[model samples]
Target: MGCGTSRPRLDDSDCNPATGSTRKSAAPITNITQSYQRARCSNTNPQRSRAIGRGGDAKPPSYEREDPRRPGQAVLNILKGGLALKREGTVNAFESCKHKRILVLIDDNHKMDRITKRAICSLASFILLIGHGYQCDMEFRWPGYNNNDSPKLGTAGSEMAKALQKLMDTKTWEDACEMIDANDKLQEVGLKTWVENQLKWKPSNDQFQFAEQYRHHLPGEAIRVANLKGNDTDEDLHRKLRVEARSIMAKHIAGWAANDIDRTHLMKLDTEARKKSERDQKLSSNLGFEYRKAMENYEREMHLGADGTPTLVILLVASPITKTEKDSIIDCQRNIMASLGTKVANGSRDAYAMQTVVFTKSMASANLKHFQDIDDAFKGHHDINDLTKVEETKFCKNGPSPELLAKIFNSNLSSIDKSELGERELYSQEILTDGKGDIQWPSHEDVMRTFRPDDGDSDSEG
Candidate 1:
């Protein structure tokens, strides 16, 4: 039959009578191939299909453009959905959301859930919005939010309060200024007002008195004395001035102690007295003993010319002896006299034959050569008796008695003994040896080496 003539009987075989050979039917084959080509073309040209629709030359539906300034519609939708879920008490929207950050809106009427509050706080950063009727307030809290600790938040005011406190405590404008300047925040408070107030402030009476005392001394003098010159900066000059002012005040206090006999004045010089009094219970008693001893020494020197006074006073003018060396010499002489069966009286003469008086360099009014000649006369004698024959014709114009010479020589011997025993003790054997024989004088070092502490002689104590 012809391919289009009559319908052929349905058969599973691939043979066609029209083709006259074993082949698939052409009509069915053509229909299958056309359907596959259409499908393949549609798959490969998807953009062309999207650009054109059933209407032909049609465009895709466009979305409304988002305003750059306003929140996105998606964000608004999510917020609305979250609020609806929160009202329904389904899950806490802030906790259930996969978003790393979210805005939390709080109103006067809305009660915030604890978990929502904690989640908001735990976020790395978030915006907090508060609604007040028609108005909304927004605040941002980030990783480095410092609550009330920032200098912008009354830190300068707090520092100013502390500076005022220090001002009240120190009562000095300079000290208060220094404290205020040390704080960066307080320094922003300005110094003009502080300076004006300081100028108006009246000093206490004691402060006025101290200022008056140092009124003649210039700040330049302090700078010079402190050895702060070209090398020192302006700040160093100001610091040195303050230190020098303090030192001058201390010196004034010390002068009061030295010149005046008042106990109060002396106590002023003893800055550590209060601390010592706190630590030592017997501090007051010890001070009393020292004062009494000083008074006794003063009285003995004042009454040197009184009767029964065996002490002979010698004035040393421009003597080579220093005060310390002189004192050591005198102590050594007293010890030697004590060993010779003659005891030096503590106060008035009791049984001692003679007491030698040694004057300081300040007391000497005589010629320098006269004192030098006297020093030569008493130089080498070991025995006190031998010193009595020293000629005093050159020492004094009218030659004083040999007994006076003995007193001077004995006093001088004490110094010689101390020198021999103290620093020159090692060479004493060579230096003190006369042509006749060794004087056998004991040095202070030898005495100290042989000395032993007395184990409580309780019977003698009784």
Candidate 2:
């Protein structure tokens, strides 16, 4: 909920869901891997449209939608079914009271006759108890096994103790009550005496006074009103009314305490909710700031100079690069520029400022050669080796080849700087002896004469 602001609508086809004719792959995509690949295409734009009869024979013909026979889809369906089975298994185990076994692991008996019957069929009996978290301790004894007489008692006791401990650690009274309420076999217990005892204690001393406030009903209050039977008298129904009132009150009280509900708890909850709201607001603000900051950084990366005038126009340049490749290349380029920061020769103040232009497919296609020239001037990212090393281990199951990548790079190089290279000198020669080399070296006088100004009449007057 506190994530970044919604981005502006770019285009219909740019979204993942909007991409046509793509099937969900078998292997799940890893977040780190996805991010790495995205670096290469960060500044590039998606290709507008596939060229007809070119670039892999104009998108393959649409096949009939595979039904229950589709390989990938079938695997996915099976996976979903497996997950469902696991959930069902967990529920079945709980209902059967499999958790009741082992000493000191008691379960609240449910009122449902069917559930208890099922548990009995499975040779399990749960002791009904109330309250939340670690409600009650149990001492379990197997039907055929004697705890005191058996030679394996110590081991059995230890195992049972550990099992119970684990169950109690995870189970709660609220969960127990919900489970018990689902059964019809268990009878509801009244809390009239318990409520009276609770009330007898001073409100100041009672730790659960806040919980009692909502739960404990005062004497003589009606639990529910209903039409009386024709033969039933007021006195006969009075006893029934009292039982119902106590049951209702007991249920409420049990629920409140079991859920850790109190005035203090409520106040704490309110405070937390308020803090979360404030945090969300702050997060939203931060996201806006980050977006602006990222844009500013991008601008500086593209523009070569600190001059405020925007040099690079935001364009829809076509990129053959995938998301993964884009992210990698961007990271590589960033690192390379950082390494060369001090070494790069700057003729003017503006020369040092460099901003990278993120382009879309349309922009790349509109002025492809010029952009390619610009790319060439930069000589491509030096970190191309890093990507190649990655490619050695990780192969794209479905993707364009590195040759295609190189082709895209070459094609885009024409759009960048137009320059020719001169023969590189390995080393400058030093004349140890004047006659050591056949090549004639310039004398000091010759060098001076070459640099001298032409003679003029004004110089003669001086």
Candidate 3:
């Protein structure tokens, strides 16, 4: 046999190369074993023939060798496929772009998922190593699954809801308390177990990472102590202080009460003070007084003359006075001027010089008699120097002619003479005059002679 030759199978009875024979032997297995040992010692391909004899498929040894570059190639293929999909446009350009964007997002998510898995695995490995009494920090980059089968996050609320519903239906306080306590304890245990399982690399079937959303925050003191070397940056410190301040502000706001008796009393006092101030302002700005002052100022500024002004701008009521009561009327005028002076300081020129005027029918009949009395009464009075003026006119009854009465009563002479002068009224009868200055008052005979009586009346009477 050659040194590098293959061993013969048990079915092939040709044991020696010098003689080839096919025969059934009692120790055929012995011959095959001897030949296999010899082939092994001679460095022949005995393993291939052995595999064939055992009904195993023969394969090249190169197939067992792992390619170190295969992972990189796979990553490249995936990237190329992604790019190809992106470049390939569809009839609906919007949907294509949207799909591409989603694909890119999915790719980024996959990368993040890989990184997260590696991080979790590293942490879990660290925990395991710590359990086995390892002291050094170890970083791992391999991915792992967390297959833990604990109750999912947020389920505690549902459980509480069920218990609360039961308590509402039954109205048992003790049972409700027990249920709450039990739920609290259950939540605490669940939290602890979940943390333990995460640290121990247990796999989870959840679609989302619960720890990602519901994180256990470390205490501020613990964080500060952990950062003994003052590694915290300025931004981090500011953020921490801001968060603390916001928390404090929130606590104060949550406990705030608007109905505090002291605060309410203070507010009432403030409101009363404001109202009093408004009232004082209103009293100070008296519209009537201000209006009078404004009118006086305007008249003084404009320098208006009596001819350009009205005889009476306003009418005021006054009692009729006799000529003997002239001093009393003058005193009243002085008082009115004083009141006008108090309301308006600059009373040099006003709509009314004396601010009041009194007129009586008897004074009008006496012409200048009552007028002189009024002037004399106010002449020496220091308060009514230029501030007062009095005037009188003829009375309607004692006028120079009946025209005065007509003007006073705003009526025709006929109507006035008939009402006041009686039967001796003017224009009582129709007068006829010719151009020769002869006038005649028609008597009843003349009027009857001018008009004939109706014939029908004359015939009916006789």
Candidate 4:
């Protein structure tokens, strides 16, 4: 029979035509050999088939096989002109547009310089390309960014396009470093890695809420580096970013400390603020007409006016203790504030008051975001005793400065009675006291009475 055009083979038994390849004889082939053979065959296929099997390779299939784009070249062409680079290299170019924006996604751990260049270049190209082609938006997605497993683009296709335009135009490493270092999340995931990992994790509904809630607590640098797409196009966006970044860093650092330390710091901040406000409030009130009228009852208690301005001081405390115990401590502190409010008004003989009162909020918020930093301290099984040194130092550094206190007092002088003030105590007596009753000091009469306690009826009655 004549050779058929559809099928032709030299050996029917030994040759393997299963893959449409000419196998000289049946020989066990390794994986590498099989791959090479399949590629060779696919290349020799019809034009349509060849195009269909183009992206089969060891790395990601999206990488082109025959493209001439070199490493370090702008990948914008890939997104814009439907181009792909077969080689592995990084681009260090930057471009900008007058008013248009271009999205540039990259591996988060990629060098800041490189990312900056790509962003600038992409933006410039976007301005030019979109101007002529379509006047539309474009998105860039870096895979495996910020612990993300997949890829994502921005809603408006990367609002960072404009900011990047500015960054490239200015080319300020100092500014970039300042911003990056200030970021709380940047420290956690690292600068370039944030971008890459973000590719893996898409924003879910819950995750979006979570990010929004804690967004204010991150450092400016961290937020800028973490999410560059907050394109509000307002000057306040930068200010808000700066403030939020600082708050995030504070919260994160607090989390790194042990639960006790975290809780203590939170309590300290809240206590100090509340004390100042209470002092002002009680002082104001006392200085008011009501205090003037009530002071007639007690000359000693009449001097200072009541100050009742409410102040907000929130402290986030993370503790290793049971939640119930933490709640109890918080409750006790609140009760102290409540009790002090009454004592300030009634004029008990021994009723001494602080210009500011100690009211603490939970430290749970601060410690939650930065547990990794302080994990060692918390896990070492240290008790409250271990906290003395740290707390003392922290109190000295972070506690209200005498200058600030003076300012507050000076500002509210009308209500605050500075005359009765004495040496400041480091720890509140309220903290040490059990609050059940006053500690007793026995007298000589009591000593003799103990010996005379043999009177059964009298002793029983006592």
Candidate 5:
């Protein structure tokens, strides 16, 4: 009997393969008091043997402590107030505390404003809303606005956030417009919309990247969308424009032409009409131009910039045609009308800080927030485009100037860019009424109050 004995094997199953002999078992009896004893190779566990690092095959893993946060996630957490980048404190409504943040979430990102963009995307900029101008801008926390979606990781989240914030700065409007114009990616999505025509873009917090990636190339065709957003915020000048256009066309075409000339044929006649006998053709050629400029001039005179001068932020033709023409002369010219409309809308924005939009159809702008749909929202105050002397005085209060109505019937509209208009081009959608948009829309007061509930409480004391 031995102190460390092994039971005898029934067969030579413990033979060493290398030596072709039975393996020797124990030298185990040597140190009886030792708690730690080295085991013989034969007694070593197979799993433990494999775990030991062998010559030139492998080595044990070595690890060092590190911060667990990803750069993007960390920056995002700070923005959402899940983590603290700045000192933690809570004070008044002026303070950029967690409680002060206003998280604005909209499932629909189709139409957005500049402030909405900043509030949603950029954490750094969202804090800057407080104390921007009139008072402290409450912090607006946009849902899912964390910087996890940047194209690049690491500093990309912070960098992208900063870039988004900077894009929306009041000082950056001109640069942003220019950038959108130059960058084909931006122009594809930006220029086609009502907002872009006014030199505005969606500078939202979270989805600017998504917009850039998926802003598929919309049909490059020209659209027939017109809006009259001008200094007359209280007036539905677009309806007036429609009435004016109808009046002008009706007046010119009453005895001038017997037949309804196809717009395409009329254009050909206008081009070839060097002969005096082609008087009707000549008049028709100038009809679109006349309509455009008269409306432009009307828009120009009615609206004023922040400095009291004419605002020329945008100059779109404000035509009321619903869509591209199969044959209608009415639907033929829409895109160029914006040249005047933009000025009106921009002036309103500059002078009054009002949000304005012009859509061909009431349905086109459905579900949009923070904007006044001039075409869909306001009704015409006058039946005819050429306002009566009394109506004119009532509309402007200071009275209409001779210079403003100078070119009601004539040539020389070279001041505007010609490229905006095209006979062959057409817009992607049609939502407005056929012919002049004479359908009765609601009053301006109701439309304005619909966008902001707090503004309509004039009857109630705070």
Candidate 6:
């Protein structure tokens, strides 16, 4: 209930949902990674956490965090305490729950009884570990079209890992920087400026080659997030961090993280409700009727206690998640089209609205540093195969290439050739013009025609 700054002790029984308990002796994450996690939770109560976050047509995240320290431990403690106390927060769409839209993942419409919630903090951890010089003892899995067809964290991880691996091969930060400066990869990538200017990464006094600020993620924490097969993500809690971490996140990842996390939480609530009623014999004719009813009950109760409970929908995705895929997910949610519901009949909406309130990491900390690099340095994050490369991969996925869609948009319906339009271009046209062969901007006459009052049926007539 109290989001205090006290963290879990090194020998404490940290609640790890993966193994059910953890024994890893950990430290305050040094920099970048650990700081990012703390930053995720700290933004939970703030009004402007996401004011400056991932953009360029990106959507806001769904879930939020409350704890200023260890997210996993904070949630476990709350679960240990109870869900009866207040945990209220907000996002762009959580209010839609009241309008009767229960957000669902509905992956490929495979009649999945299980819902998958995307933990952004979990994702941040996943993203943070890519090149932090630590190898996860487990395989971090992100399921795709199928198990074998899942997406990967892109070459950014291996790239960062390779760089850090070579860096760690050195005895100290100064030596590491020298090796990088003298290296071919540095020269080939032309990262000498980034290395010498952006990433000095001086070593900690403890003799580790890592930066004193490098918040080295715990190995157990890494593994817990790797395989998201269970409720391993600290659903009940979240993170926050220092300036450097906050600056990068604020300028970069926050928006997507919030949007995705909220969507994931709703997905989980639906799945859990179905699991609660999978054995019901009185299921209606609707395929997920029982699921709907179970969720209806959940909504009835959660909303009734809405005044007393804390609803958090915060997440930070930096893995195999992509702009193309993330957009599709939103279209499914906002009803632009049935991308995920292509096979399944989307004949009905959920019987309830989302009631969980998560304070989002939407706006960045208002008191951010006015550093030159903070704004343009991290924009390339949107392009990572998954967001893993810590040192930055391609120096912001900005260039002339991204403007092709806008170029396409400039063409009128009768102007461009249809057969040759690429898939993304097709999709862009689909949403904007709605596949109706024209992009319409309705005039006053159209609005009047749409909602014209029936003859003598107007209240004025009465």
Best by TM-score: 6
Compared with the true structure, what per-residue lDDT tens digits does model 5 show for residues 203-303?
A: 33254445444434433331112112212221232223223323332212210120222223322332232222132221122323333433343444445
lDDT against the true structure, each candidate = 0.27, 0.25, 0.26, 0.27, 0.25, 0.25
Least accurate stretch of 10 residues (summed lDDT) in model 1?
125-134
TM-score for each of the candidates: 0.15, 0.14, 0.14, 0.14, 0.14, 0.17
Residue-level lDDT for 90 in candidate 1: 24
- Model 3: weakest 10-residue lDDT segment is 100-109
TM-score computed on alpha carbons, candidate 5 = 0.14
Compared with the true structure, model 1 gives a TM-score of 0.15
Candidates in order: C-alpha RMSD to true structure: 47.7, 35.7, 60.2, 35.8, 33.4, 29.4
Model 6 regions lying over 4 Å from their true place: 1-151, 161-171, 181-183, 193-462
lDDT winner between candidates 4 and 5: 4
Put down candidate 6 lDDT per residue, 192-287, tens digits, no spaces: 554432332323224234432233554766534422312322211111111111122111111112122322343343344334334321221221
Residue 304 of model 1, lDDT score: 46
lDDT of 3 by residue, 268-348 (tens): 332343343343321121212212332343344334433323111111101223444444455555555455444333323
CA shift at 4, candidate 4, in angstroms?
Answer: 99
Query: How do the residues 1-462 of candidate 2 rate in per-residue lDDT, one tens digit apiece?
Result: 000111122221211212222334344433322222222223223442232224464552322121222112222222222223222123211121222211211111122133221222111111111111123222322111112322333554434333322222223433323333443222233223332333333343354455346435634332122112213343333333333332232212111121233223322332343343343221111212222232343335434444433211111111233333344434544555565564333321112122222222223343434333333334332211111111100111111122221221122222212222121211112211112211112222222222232422322320
Residue 244 C-alpha lDDT in model 3 = 29
Candidate 1, after superposition: displacement of residue 344 in Å? Answer: 91
lDDT at position 41, candidate 4: 44
